[model samples]
Target: MCVEKTPWELVIDFHGHTCPDIALGYRVAQLAQREMGIRPAPDSECLVKAYTQSCALDAVQVLNKATIGRRALIIEETQHHIYQFHFTGTQEIHQFTVSSDVLDHLKALQHPDLSPRERQNKVLEGVQYVLTLEESAFCQYDKIPGELRKL
Candidate 1:
């Protein structure tokens, strides 16, 4: 039977695998959408600035429609899980900074000694950990004033 995949499933498919990074990105994208409340207007667009490069970004590109090719997704090498969403024509920017607790936990999962199968299992565990994390514990939410237009 051909079944329709859920949005999360589509993100996983677009990302090519399920991992903590993608899970983190998916959560950030979903939260950003909820926090923003409304969709963009005809003249306004939602732009994303990501501080660090990770597989998580694939989720943002999929769920937020902020693709790098379109110049709507900006990525930096700051190496942090911080994301800023700017709604053009608005006065505020929404920033989400992933917490240290979550970061540390994900880091602790990495090990070079495990077998391939073991590594795969750990990766799956990490994905589950991130997907089920409490929303409030996932990241710190902040509303900062900034220039909204990307240009």
Candidate 2:
């Protein structure tokens, strides 16, 4: 006996914008490795894992189109606000979606009370401290408020 099913096309559009916080993480890791001699991130294993997962087909959808014949299932997602081919499937498959967690740390860092100068200084100091073995002279004494520097 043979079985036949109605042809259909399914498209899932996940609409959301990914901010640059992810890039900030990469910058931090790069700074640590370059200046402090810390191990660089996105290690080989993780990179390989990401490539493997991304290359894997997620699903297959039978399309009713006449000329094209059938449409491969697609699972689309946005990263850093760029859209890319997430998954392709030849057979029915399950796709995994990663939801972002609201990082409380970011909230604290983003507090408006910190003047723009202060915020920039914090980012700079944080990066500097993380990337150096010796305490910088600027860090030892009271930090000259970035405001004063402008004056």
Candidate 3:
């Protein structure tokens, strides 16, 4: 018998491995879908503007159907885990910023003292943390004032 893969499974497969960044991206994509409605909304064209570069973008592409190949995902190196979503069907834009608490933990995982193995283990733990974090604790969301979505 064959079983279908969950969205998270597909994202992990595409990303080649799981990490905090991938988990972060997964949560962001799921929340964006919740906030903006599922993909292929009638006559809708969706674009994602990410303020940082990381494996998280993979989740957005896998789950949100916003891919760099399609020119639907743009990255600006603001060094923050902020993601914005725009749809041609609506003037409103949805924005999500990873919370500082989570960011702090992610930074702690990067300490120089930890051995490579230790860091890897901690990162896996972080993946679980990010995946299980309370919805409100994971990120902050907002709806920006409607404006023409620029290409």
Best of the candidates, lDDT: 1
Local accuracy of candidate 1 as per-residue lDDT tens digits, 1-151: 9999998999988988889999999999999999987866877778999999999899999998888888889887799999999878887899999988999998899999999999999898888988899978889999999844443
lDDT of each residue in 1-151, candidate 3, tens digit only: 9999999999999999988999999999999998987644776878899999999999999998888987889898988999999887677889999998998988787868889899899988899899899988999999997733445
> How does candidate 2 score on lDDT?
0.24
Worst 10 residues of 1 by lDDT: 142-151
For candidate 1, the TM-score is: 0.93
Q: Candidate 2, 6: how far from true, in Å?
A: 48
Model 3 lDDT, full chain set: 0.89
Regions more than 4 Å wrong, model 3: 39-41, 147-150
Whole-model lDDT per candidate? 0.89, 0.24, 0.89
lDDT of 2 at 147: 15
Clashing pairs in 3: none
Shift of residue 149 alpha carbon in model 2, Å: 53
Worst 10 residues of 2 by lDDT: 44-53
Tell me the lDDT of model 1 at 65. 89
- Candidate 2, residues 27-98, lDDT tens digits: the string is 222322233232234331100001111211211111101111222222233342111111111111111222
